[model samples]
Target: MELALGELLDERLITLDLQATEREGAIRELAGLIDRAGKLADRDEYVNAVLAREALGSTGVGHGVAIPHGKSPAVREAAVAFGRSRTGVDFAAPDGRPADLVFLIAAPEGAHDLHLKALAHLARRLVHDEVREALRQAGSAHEVVRVLAQA
Candidate 1:
């Protein structure tokens, strides 16, 4: 069976609701969550590596969403974590808007297709305004996961 974001998260390979002040801080917070979630071996090294990858190109695809992703030997498998900002964070989105929803993805270096699928699913699901609103109003990580599961 294909792995869903909720499932992977439930299995302890993901995390949610990371508080960050800026772009780099957001990425670092996500990396720490992923590291603590048991997907990566080294927290600081993994966070820095993903940050360096983001420096190559802005992952802020716009529409209040940013998908920051990278592959690393630190990742044991494909995983994703969601973070929401009620006030929005300045991500330098291509649309010239701050990002309210962010998804950080880290996959094993070899799991290219799985990572792509996960990204596509995240993009597709977030396209709906209702989902966005629901995410914004979501009370907890479980609620966020429920929203994604229903999507």
Candidate 2:
């Protein structure tokens, strides 16, 4: 399958100014964004799944980025929510730094391989400093989509 980050990311799910100050709170806020976008049937259930995944290991990949994801029956489809925290949040990254860019991925329970592929693709793109900077400077959800489309 061709994984298009732009397709998975809804403008409504992009928050340029994230209000959460911690990892759990950030996840909750991002999950709420996805839920409000109608990507999730149950917001709390999806949040719990993401939290469970976090318990296994921090998704904080360093470079001020954190990708928190989960597979759940509550997820209606594969979707991504992006949040930018100007103040940064403590995500327990390996580099021991706060994360300013957060991507919350929600995938349906049946899409095991597809979800992994999507996550891998996103991770690869995020490794570039340019992409991170572009996302950080993005003015709106449309701008964010434009940046991710280039990835």
Candidate 3:
């Protein structure tokens, strides 16, 4: 993947303790981070895009992970918001497991498929047990960044 996940991920985008109870809520919670970081041009539009994508198919990739993304004109740039929950949220995973690690990606419509690249890269990285364990045990946002950077 040409796009470095580290470029889209940062301490400001990481949430180690998520309070969301379900999929939609978790998405909204993470998308709010993108909005606050000034990457989202229009919160409602971007959120709608993500929800629409979810309607087409669940983004839950199994293994306690979910990657929800939106490629929309409402995004100013590519950004990722990550949340970790102690109590998992239902994401309709085929494995029938709730997701504790959630990633919300916002990509500008003109970002040249960066979102797909990020998704693929994260999928590849998270497939490793060490990476997932590091994420789960990360104590701070900086730790999360360090994990992704190294992974």
Candidate 4:
């Protein structure tokens, strides 16, 4: 079954933090989000592994958005966390623009296409600027999830 971002969040699978800076700061911020959301085993391990993946290529898909993901055995299930940088973070976005929306995803090493499909689903959902703006202006984490659910 296809899982909605908000549904995952409603299950406490995701959390969002509105305070974040650009580039490296975004990654650090995601670590805190994961910890608070209760989805990660080891905080640093999760953060480092994601960063290592970013080293290969920037996850920033431009248009003020970035999706950083990693596949590792440390994860118990596929999960995602959301973060917003009001000032926009320099995530090395291919378009050379700072990213205001960020999604951090972690999946088990054996999940295969499921992980990629989830990322693709997210990227596709972001095609609408209105949805992006709604996510940006959402007041609470629940609101964020609601907006995503609607989209």
Judged by TM-score, which candidate is best? 3
* lDDT by residue for model 1 (2-112), tens: 567775554243334556868888877777677777788766666766787778988887888888887777787567877887666787788988888888888777776
Better of 2 and 3 by TM-score: 3
The regions of model 4 sitting more than 4 angstroms off are 11-17
Write the residue-wise lDDT of candidate 3 on 1-151 in tens digits: 3678888988888899999999889999998888999888899999999999999999988999999898999999789999999999998988989999999989999888788898998998999989999999999999999998889
Question: What TM-score would candidate 3 get against the native?
Answer: 0.97
Candidate 4 residue-wise lDDT, 23-47, digit = tens: 6667767766666666667777777
Identify the runs in model 2 with alpha carbons over 4 angstroms from their true place. none
- Ten contiguous residues minimizing lDDT sum, candidate 1: 9-18
lDDT of 2 at 79: 91
TM-score per candidate, in order?
A: 0.87, 0.96, 0.97, 0.87
CA shift of 57, model 1, Å: 1.9
Model 4 score (lDDT): 0.75
lDDT value, residue 26 of candidate 1? 83
User: TM-score of model 4 relative to the true fold?
Assistant: 0.87
Candidate lDDT (C-alpha), each: 0.76, 0.90, 0.91, 0.75
- Please give the RMSD to the true structure for each candidate, in Å: 2.3, 1.0, 0.9, 2.1
As a TM-score, model 1 comes out at 0.87
